[model samples]
Target: MTELRGEALYWEAFERLKSGKAQIIDTNSPSFKFTKDNVAIEAGKKKGFVKQERYPDLCDSIENTENTRCSAASRDPENSDSIKLITSQKKKANARYSKLKAEHDLCLEKMMNLLRENFELRRELQELKKSSMQ
Candidate 1:
């Protein structure tokens, strides 16, 4: 079987996380957690494979899943301090996600502009070559 790479590997790990197929062995509690290192391990990779700079969409999905899990955990009243901590973490995750999303958009725009410029330069070069040949 061919080994998965790039977006495929990332998405596969995410699917495992979302579907509870990834093993939850390391946690002190049995609760399943959504972490980048876990997802990387799930994808048969070393830690830090799910980088925001490399895979923003996958990172965003993982963050959303983690936030949802935290929200559910926050509903438990047994530990008010834990609930407050989870809420705070959720807020921070959201803010970070927003910032990353903005940065990703700006990067995409810059990439598109560069691609257009490259194409135009190539076309101009071809025209000049043809004129010189004629």
Candidate 2:
């Protein structure tokens, strides 16, 4: 006979219960109590509701802020659009930003190159003047 241990057995039992493959024998059975405790423990861990800090309340506040921002953005007349239009506009804005950044970098590179060339020409001119005077 195969023996399951720890979380493996708990998960197998949970899956069986969820799929109706197994039934609870008694309301107050040890297996039922174990499952209930396991569920509560897993839920608390997943939601970060441990006694260390009030992370769950902080998470709720963060979610509320996100919802508020989404609602405000949707309410804006100038920014309101269907999902497709909004996605397309976002892509266009990103493309424009990228293109501008590339152009700015290219301009900076060309300016640096020009300054280096100018400095080299000035040094050559000074050498020629000194040679001609001698």
Candidate 3:
């Protein structure tokens, strides 16, 4: 048996993967935070994941009617915290994508082995037919 190296193996693997002739294992879904502080607070309360706020007034109270009174409080610091959480979740998603790609490559290698076996069998069958006809 001749050993395939470098570009030849790479192209063979690429063709097998591209032709949908490979099997892949499914991975579990990744954890991600979808909602910001306000949404999380509301969901936690409804789902009993955490204790509800004791005082509703502790939450944001700015309204159009009170805009003049709380104009200086328009800037919220909690938004930055939520943004950081989302950024970290995105990184985790990227890592999971890379893992899936590696699994696909492994599946392609198995497909190449099956393809080689099929080709060898066809060649042997042709040789046997030639010998019988002679």
Q: What is model 3's C-alpha RMSD? A: 25.5
Q: Which ten residues in a row have the lowest lDDT in candidate 3?
A: 25-34
Residue by residue across 16-55, what tens digits does model 3's lDDT show? 3334342221111123121123222322222222222522
TM-score of each: 0.48, 0.40, 0.41
Top lDDT prediction, candidate number: 1
**Candidate order by lDDT, highest to lowest?**
1, 2, 3
Off by over 4 Å in 1: 1-4, 23-32, 77-134
Higher lDDT: candidate 1 or 3?
A: 1
Clashes of each: 0, 0, 0
- Against the reference, the lDDT scores of all candidates come to 0.79, 0.53, 0.45
Against the correct fold, how does model 2 do in TM-score? 0.40
* C-alpha root-mean-square deviation, candidate 1: 16.7
lDDT of 3 at 125: 100
For candidate 2, write residues 15-134 as lDDT tens digits: 453344554333232223223333324333232222214233333433464466568757876555555586898899999999999999999999999999999999999999999999
Which candidate number maximizes TM-score?
1
